[model samples]
Target chain A: MSETTREQIRDVIGAHANLPVDIRELGDAADLFAAGMTSFASVNVMLGLEDTFDVEFPDTMLKRSVFASVDAILEALEALGVALV
Target chain B: MGSEVRAVSAEQVALRDRLIDAGHLIPSGVDGVYGHSAAFEDLREALGTRISAEARTRGATRLTFPPVLPVRQLEATGYLANMPHLAGTVFSFDGDDAAAAVQGTRASAHEDWSEFQAPTGVALMPAACYPVYPALARRGPLPAAGAFIDAGGAWVFRHEPSTDPARRQIFHQHELVRAGTPETVLQWRAQWAQLGLDLLTGLGLEARLDRANDPFFGRRGRLLAANQRAQELKLELLVPIAGPEPTACASFNHHLDHFSSTFAITGAGDDPVHTACLGFGHERIVLALLARHGLDPDRWPAEVQDRLGAPR
Candidate 1:
C-alpha cells in the first residue's frame, strides 16, 4: 500500500478510534484495544474508515481481527479493492 | 448474534409440552409467554429467597422496580444501539374516544392496530440492572466503599420468542450490581459467580461457568462480541435444560466504565467507577431444577429440598 493510504488510515483512526494515545506514536502493528479503545469506539472507527474509503465493509470483514491494528485495517481496505495510489 | 438461527429440537418441544401437561407452566398460547403455576412460582420464589439472603449478607442495598423502565434511561445506557433486536419498547394509544373506537375495530378485525399506538415514555425493562445505573447517578458521587445494589426479582423482557422454555420473553431476574474500583467490581463479580455455581450444584443441578457475550446486533456487533469475549467481560453459568446445548441460567458481566461513563457515575475525586453485575434467571433456574429433579417438589431429593428449604 502507498504511504498516502496509510496516512489516510491513520487519520481516520485518530479521529474515530478514541484511543487515548497519540496515533502517530503507535506502531503500525500496535493493538488499538490495548491502547484504551473500546468496542463501542471501534464502531466509530469502522464507520470513519468506511466514509473515508467510500466503501462498505461486508459482514465477513466485520471482525475483531480486521480492526486489531492499523496494518490490519490497511489490509482490509486493500482486500476491499481500495486503491492506495 | 441475532443473525444465527437454530432450529428448535424435538427434545425441547417435548420438555415444554411436558411442563405444560404437568401444569407447571400455564400456556398463554404464545411461544415464550406462559403463566406460572403455584408450584413453579413457589420454587422460583425459594430460589430468589436464597439469592436475596446471600445478597443481604454482603450488605447490598435492596431495591424493587416495576417492569417498565424510562425510555431515556434505556437510551442513556446505549443498550438499544447494540441490541436493538432484543429490546421491547412500550407503545400506547394516545387519541380521543373516536380514535380509540377505530383502533378497537382494527384490533377486533385481527388487523394491524399498532399504527394507532404511539411510542410511550417507557420501554419494557431489558435487564434488571438497567434501572440501577440511572438511579445511582441521581445520588451524585459514590461513597469510598462504592455502591452495592441488589436489584430485586423484576420482570425483564427481551424480544426473542422461542419454543425453548428456557428462553422466555418475560422473566424474573434477580440481579445485583456493584460500582466501584475495577478491583472491587471484579472481585464482587467473581464472588457471586462462585456462589451461584455452588448454589446450583447444591440444588442437585450440574452447572458450570463459561466465557460468554451478549447478543449484540448487526455487523459492528460481531466485533463487539468478539472483543467482549477477548477481554473476558462476560461469563455465564450454563446448565443443561432440554437439548444438548446448555442454557445460560445466570450471567456475570464486568462493565469497565461503560455504565459509569454513560450515567456519569463517579467515585471519589470524580474518577470514573468501574461496574459489574451478576444476574440469575429465576425461571430458568427453577426449570433446570425441574429438569434435573422431577415435577413434584414434595418428592425432590432430601438434600435438594433441604438446600431450597422446600417444605418436607
Candidate 2:
C-alpha cells in the first residue's frame, strides 16, 4: 500500500475522532467500533474515504462490520482492489 | 405538566386489543413505537369518512392512494436524502428460476416461497404526501392560484420502534396538501397548523404547537436539525403521551419548492409550484386522546364525542 493512501485513511479517521487518535495504535486489523468509532461518524469517514480515493463503495462494502476500525477499513478497501494512494 | 381531558372509547380499546390478539398489531412494547393491526381498517375507514366530509365542507377533492410506491420515483424526490433511514425498499430476486421454483414448492416450502416473493413489488411508502406531487405534476399546470387535495392513507411505515402507540412503525395519516402560488401554499399550511391544534384541543388533549426538527438521522443529522431551525420548515402540534416530553401528533410542513423543483411540478405561468403539506398521524392522535382521556368513550364530553361521531 502507498504511504499516501495510508496517510489519507489516517486523516479521515483522525478527522472524525473526538480526540486525537494514535495512528500507531491502529493496526491494519484493529476493530474501529471497539476503538470507539460511532456508526454515523464512521459513515462520514467512509464518505470522506470514498471522495479522497475517487472510489465508489459497492453495497456490500457499506456494512458496519467492514468499518469496524481504521485497520478494518483499509483491509476492506484492499480486498476491493482499491490501491492505496 | 398540565392535566387534560381523556376521550378514549371502549370501542377503541376493544378494537386495539382484538387486533393485537390477532397478530395484526405487533406492539414493540416500547414507549414510542407504533404498531399496526387489522383493526386499523375499521378506524381508518371511519376517519376517512370524517375527513372526506370535512373536505367537502371546504370544497376540496378527496383522493385515495395505494400504500406502495416506486422506488425510482421516491429517489427522484430526494426522499432518500431527507429520510433514507426511514424509507423501506422492496427487493426481488433476479434469479430466472426463482419464481418457478417457488410455484413448485410443497406446503412447507410454500411459506418460504411467499417470504421470497415479498420483496418484489416496491418500497413501502413512509408518508402519504410523497405520491401526490408526481400525480399532480402529471396533470397540467396548477390552477391560476392553487389547489387543495385531501388524502387519507394507511400502511405508512417509520423505522421508530417506540412502545408508545403514538410512534408506530405503520399507521394512518390524514393529510391535506396544497401546491401552487407561494402565498397560497404557505397560507394553507399556517391555517392548518392552527386548525389542527384546535382539533386536538377539542379532542380534550392539552396540545401545543412548536417547531419540530426532522426525525433524528445519523450524527450529521444534527446538522439537519439545525438547518430546520434556520429555515423553519416544520411546525408540529404535540401532546403529552406517557411522560414529560410531548409526542407530535400532527405536523405542518412548508416544503417551499423542494417537491415542485424535484418533481418538475409547476404552477400557473410556469412558476415552480410552492408546496406544503399538513400530516395527521391518526393513530398517534388516538393514542394521545386515550392517554389523556380514560378508556370510556361515553364519558367524553358531548361535543368531543359528537365530533368523532361516537354513538352515545
Candidate 3:
C-alpha cells in the first residue's frame, strides 16, 4: 500500500469525524469510538471509505465493531479481498 | 461486546425467576408464550394509558389491531424482504380431521408436531405499527392536515430466540404514529423522543435517547442499517433493564416516504406524507421499573408511584 492510501483514509476520517484528537494522534490500533467517534459519524466514514476505496462493504462488515478502529476497517477491506495501493 | 460473550447475566436470571415466582410471568414451557399476571398486566396497561394520554391530547386518533397480520399487508410493508429471518408466518392444518389427529398424536409427546400444519397465509405482526399503513391507505387519501394514529397491539412476534429477558419473543407496542408533511412528522418524532426520555427519567429510571436501528436482514440490510443511522432515522430510549448494555424501552422511527409510497399516503400538495412512530415496549419498561425499584410496586419511589398511579 502506498503512503497515499493510509494518509487518504486518515484524511477522510479526520474530515468526517467530530472528535477532539487530531488525525495524527490516532494510531492504527486506536479505538476510534473510544476516542469519541460515534455511530452517526461512523456512517459518514463508511461512505467516505466506500468512495475512497471504490469498494462497497458487504452486510457482514457493517457492524459498529468493524468501524471501531482504522485497523479493524483495514481488516474488513482485506476480508473483502480488497488490495489497497 | 460480540454475541459470543452475551450469555445471560445472573442479575437477569434472578429477576426472571423473581417475576415467575411472584406470578408475574406464567410459563407455558414454550420459548416465547407466557401467561401474564393480572398485576403485571395492570401495570403495563396503566403505563400505556399514562404515556399515551399526552399523545392523545395532541389529536392522535386511537386504533388497535389483532396480533396476526394478513399476508398481503406484510407483503405491502416489505417486511419479509428486509428481515425474513425475523418473520414468523402463521400456519395451520388445512387437511382433514384424520390429518389433524395424526399431527395431534405426533405432537402429544415432545416432538416436532408442527410439521403437520400448513401455511394459513398470514404472518405474525412483527411491529405494532406494521398494519397501520395499509389500513390507512385503504381509507383513500389522507386528510389535509394528514393523519395521526395511536396504534399498536400485544403479542407482536419476532423469531429471535435468546436468553435475554429484555429481548422477549412476545411483547406489546403502543405507538403514537404520525403521517403528515415531512417536517411535521420529523418534528413529532423529535418531540416524542424528548417526551419519552423525560417520562422515563421523571420516574427515576436511567433513560437516554440515542441512535439505534432495526435488526435488518443480511447483506443489503447492512447498507440499509447504515443509511438509517446516517440519516438519523431511528432513536431509542434505553434503560439498563438486565445486562451490561441498557435495554431499549422505547424507539422513535422516521420512515421517510417509505410507507407513503407503499400505501400511497399523501399530505398537502398531494406530496407523500412522511411518517414517524414512537413505540413503547410495554413489558420491557415494566421489567425495567421493577428491576430499578423493587418487585412490589408499592415500594417504588413515592413520586413515581403517584405519577403512574401505582399504590404506595
Candidate 4:
C-alpha cells in the first residue's frame, strides 16, 4: 500500500508539474520545483494527491517544502502515519 | 441570456485598445498607471455615491485613508511575508546637499541614484483596508456587535505592471470592512458577495460569484492557495472584462483572525475580532461597463443607468 501510494502520488505530481523533463528520469530526492512546478500548477497536483489518497491535507501539512521533492513528499505522508510498504 | 452575452476572447487586450481610442483612459508615462478622463472619474464618483447610499442604509461609518500607508503598520500585518512581490514601499533621499549632488550626477547618468535614498518609513497603501485595522486598534475595545467602516473609493497601489487596461498600477477600491465575531463578519461578506453579482447582472452585465485565491507568494504560497480554496476563504465576482476567462472585478476576503490578531482588535468577551472586507475595483467596473454596454453612458441600458444613477 505504501509503495502504491508513493508511486501514485509521484505520478500525479509529474503529470501536473508541467516540467520540461520527464519526472520518471529524476531521482526520488530531486527537487520538483527546481524543474518547473509553478504555484498555479501545484494546486492541481495537490488536488490530485488528495483524490488518490482519499484524504484532504490538513492545515498543518500545507507547506511548500512538503511538495519540494519526492522524498520530502513521502516524509510528509509519513507524518500522516501512512505505513511505508 | 448567458449564452447571448458575448464572451470576448481577450477583454483586457480589447479594453486597452478600445478605451484609449475612445478617450476614456489616457496613458501616463509609467507602466501600470493611466490618467482617467472626466467621464471615467464621473463613473467612479457615481459608483461611490451609490455604494455610499447603501452603506448609510446599513449605518456603516465611512472613512478614507491617504494613498501612503505607514510602513510599520503595514509590516505589522505581516502581509509582506506572503506577498512581498505585490507591495511598493515609499523611499526618499535623506542625504546632505553634497550627497544630493552626487545622487544627482548618478541620476543624470542613468545610474542607480535611487540606491542613496533612504526608506520613507512608509509604503503606498496596497489595499483600502490596510489602515482600518490600526485605526480600530487606537480605540480600546470593540462594541458588542463590533463595527463596520465604509472606505469609499480610494487609490491603492500594486506592483503588477500590465498592458491590460483593467489591471492598473494604481486603482480605486470602494471597500466595506467589518470587524466583529466570526459569524458577523463572515456572514456579512458572504451576503455582499452574492449581492454584488445580483447588482451587476441586474445592470445587464454577465456576472458570477466564484471561489478564488489571492496571488500568494512562492511555493509556500501554493499551500496557502490550496488552504484558502479548501476553506472557501475568498470570493470573487467575475465578469468577462477581457479574454476567454472571466476577470475578477470585486473581491470578498474573510480574514478570520488575521487582521484582528495583528492590530489587537478585541470584541465582546475580549476575544480577538474576526474581519472581512468587500472591495469593488472602480476602474475595472467602469471598464466592464464600457465593454458590455456602449462607452457612452447616455446610450447604456436604461436599467443600468438607473442603477448607476444619472451620468454627468
Candidate 5:
C-alpha cells in the first residue's frame, strides 16, 4: 500500500469519529467497534470509502463484521482485489 | 349487498393460524396493533415476493430503504404542515442524572424524556413514496420523462386503530412511484390501479374502484377535502372486509406536481415532474383475500395462488 493511501484511509476514519474522540490517536490496527463506531456510522464510513476509492461495495461486503475495524476493512478491500492507489 | 357476507374460508383461517404459529401475528388483545409476532414478517415476505416480480417485469430497480428518516428532511418536504395529526414523534432523555438514566434506574424529571428524541429521527415514514422523492431530487433531474422505483416497507405508523387486521397501527405498504411528465406518470398510475384490481380479483376478493379523499390537514383541510372531492385525486381498490363496509386494499394517488414542486424533483427537460403513486397495504389485501377465500393454501383458487406465486 502506498503511504498516501494509508494516510487517506486514516483521514477518512478520523473525520468520521464522533465528538469527544479523535481517530488520529488510535493505532493503525485499532478496533473501530471498540472506539464507538456505530452500525449507522459504519454505513456512512463505507459510503465514504466507496466514493474515495471510486468503487462500489459488493453486496457480500456490506455486512457489519467486515467493516468492524480499519484492519478488517483493508483486508476486505484487498480480498475484493481493490488495489490501494 | 346485504349483511349475509360468506363465512371466512378454512384456507384463510389456516393462513392466519400459520402466521400466528410463526409468531408473525402478535395479538394486541384489542385486535388492532399489527406488530406482535410473525404475521408482520409473513406479510412482508409474501409481499416482497410479489413486489420483486412486479419490479423485474416493469424494469424498475428494487430499493430497500431504512424505516427511520431524518426529521429535517421530512420538514423540508412540508410533511409536518400537511399531516401533523398523523405524525408520531420521538423524545429523548434530558434529565440531570444522566448515568442513572442509562441504567434505566432513574426516571427523568422531564416526562417527555421517557418517550424518545423529539423531531424523532424522521416522522415514521407514513408512505413508501416519502423517501424516494428526495433521493430522486438529489440525483438532479430525471431522464427525459421520469423514473420508477419499487418501494416495500413495513412498520409504517398510522394513528388509526381498527379491529380488522386490515387496519392496524403498523402495517406493510408496497408501492410503485413514478415521477415524470403528467402523461407518463398518470398513465402508469392508472395502469397499476387496473393491475392491482385485477390482482385482487384474481385472488377471489370482490374489489371495486372508488374515489377517495386525502386525509387532509387543519381548518382549511375541510376545504382541501372538499376540493379533493372535486378533483378526485385519491382512488381506491375496495374489498368487503367485514359485512357491508369495504376496506381499501390499494390506492392510486395523482399528486400533480405537489411532491415534485415540494422536493424540487424535475425531469431532464427542466420541467416539473408530475408524480403518481400506487400504494398497496399488504396486510389489508391479505386480510381481504383471507376473508373472501378461505385460509387453506391448497384450497385457494388456482388463479389467486398463481398471482401470488404460491406454490402448488
Candidate 6:
C-alpha cells in the first residue's frame, strides 16, 4: 500500500517534473531540480500533486524541500494528511 | 504588512542621521521614504547624465517612463506570483462622497479602510525594464543587430520599509536593456558590468562586482535564488554605504528567454530573443559617494569632481 502511494507520487512527478532523464530511471531520493526540473516545473508538480491527492499545499509547504524529490513530495503529501494506502 | 517588525541596525541609524543632519535627505516621517535636497538631486542627476552619455556613445536608443505602470502589464509579468511580498499596487476609493466619508472615518480611527478602496488601473513600476519588453514586442521583430535601449533614470517602487536611508521605498534606476541573440545579450551584460564598476571607481567610491540574486519571497523562492546564483544570472556592483554589508548600487540581470518568451519578443529571424538589463540605483550611488567621500560634493576629490562634471 505504501508502494502504491509512492507510485502515485512518482506518476505525478513524471507527468509534471520536466526532468531531462526518464522518471523511471530516477530513485526516490534523486534531486529533481538538479536533474533539470526548473522552478516553473516545480510549480506544475505542486499543482499536479494537489489534483492527484485532492490536497491543497499551504504557503508554508510551497518550498523546494517539499518538492525536491519523489520521496520529498511523498513526505509533503503525508504531512498534509493524505492517508497512505 | 503592519505586523512584521523591521530591524534597523545602529549603523544604518547613524548614517541616516548624518545624511539628515547634512541636509542631503529630508525625512518624511516614514521609514524608507525621504525627499532629496537640491544637492542630492543634483548629484543624482549628474550620475544619470554620465550614464546616459556613456550609453549614447554605445549607440543605444533612449526611452523614458513614469513611476507607474499599467496594472495589466504588471500582472502579465508574473511578479505578483513570484515576489508578491515586494510588489506595491495602487489602491484608491472608487465610490461617491458618502463612501469617501466612511473611508475617511475609518482612516481617522486607524481602522481597516481597504474594504472601501479598489485597485487602481496602475501599479508602481517595480523595475525600469518591466515595460521595455512589451513595448519592444509591439514593434515586431528587432533590427538585425537587435535592440539596445537606455531607459533613462526611471523611478521604481519596492514595498520594503526600513530606517535605512539606502533602502528607500521609491528610488530611481538609471537602467539599460538589451535584447537579441544569447551571445548579444551576454556580451552586453558583461560589458556593462565592467563599465559600471569603472564608473563607480571613477566617482572615488570603492566598488566591486559580485554574483547576486533578487530577494525572492517565500520558501519556493529560495530554490529559485539558488538556481539563479548557480547560473550566474545576476550580478551586482556593491559598495559599502551605511551598514556592515555592502549595498548593491547597481545590478545586471540576464533573463534567458524569460521576458522574450513571455512577451513574444523575437529576433529578425523570428527566433526567441534573449534579454539582459543593468540598473544603477541613483540614490544609492549618491549615498555611496557621500559615505566614501563626504556629504559636500564641492569638497570631493578633484578628479571625481571633474568626472562627475562640476555640480550643476
Top candidate by TM-score: 1
**Tens digits of per-residue lDDT for model 5, B200-240:** 78777899999986664543344344445445678999988
Task: Mark the regions of model 3 whose C-alpha exceeds 4 Å error after superposition.
Answer: A1-85, B1-7
lDDT of 1 by residue, B186-302 (tens): 899888999999999989889999999898887778878887887899999999989889999999999999999888898975556999999999999999999999888888889
lDDT per residue as tens, model 1, A1-85: 4459889999999998888899999999999988988889898899899999999988778777888898999999999999975
> In what order do the candidates fall by TM-score, top score first?
1, 6, 4, 3, 5, 2
- For candidate 5, the iRMS in Å is 21.3
Q: What C-alpha lDDT do the candidate models reach, one value each?
A: 0.89, 0.68, 0.78, 0.80, 0.68, 0.86
TM-score of chain B of 6: 0.95
Q: Please, what are the lDDT tens digits per residue for candidate 4 over residues B1-312?
A: 101112334556667878888888888867569988888888778888887788778878988789999999888876686678789998898888899999999889989887678898989998998899889878878988899899899899988777888778899988889999888887788778877887778767798888998877654465877657766888899987767777788999998777887788888775657999999998888888888888888788787888888574
Candidate 6 regions with alpha-carbon error over 4 angstroms: A1-10, A14-37, A46-85, B1-7, B108-111
- Report the lDDT of model 5 for residue B238: 90
Q: What is the lDDT of residue B243 in candidate 4?
A: 77
What count of clashes does model 6 give? Answer: 0
Give the per-residue lDDT digits (tens) of candidate 3, residues A5-74. Answer: 6677787789886667997998998988779775456767888888888888865677777777878888
- Which candidate order results from sorting by lDDT in descending order? 1, 6, 4, 3, 2, 5
List model 3 lDDT by residue over B1-312, tens digit each.
111223677777777778889888887776555678887887888888887787788887888889989998788777786778778998877778888888888888767877678889888888888878887888877887788888843568877665566667788888778888888788788788888899899888999888987776655467558757766889999899876778889999998877887778756675658888888998889989888888878777788888886633
lDDT of 4 at B200: 76
Top-scoring candidate (DockQ)? 1
Error in Å for residue B308 of model 4? 0.3
State which docking tier applies to candidate 3: incorrect
Native contacts, share recovered per candidate: 0.71, 0.00, 0.29, 0.29, 0.00, 0.24
Q: Which DockQ values do the candidates obtain, in the order shown?
A: 0.67, 0.03, 0.16, 0.15, 0.01, 0.26
Poorest 10 consecutive residues of model 5 chain B by lDDT? B1-10
Q: What is the CA-based DockQ of model 2? A: 0.03
Candidate 2 is scored at a TM of 0.66
Tell me each candidate's i-RMS in Å: 1.5, 10.0, 5.2, 6.1, 21.3, 4.3
Give the runs in model 5 whose Cα sits over 4 Å from its true position: A1-85, B1-24, B29-31, B35-44, B98-120
lDDT of 2 by residue, B155-251 (tens): 6876655434455666788888889888887777777787777777877789999987666454345444544554578898888766556778888
Candidate 4 yields a Cα-based lDDT of 0.80
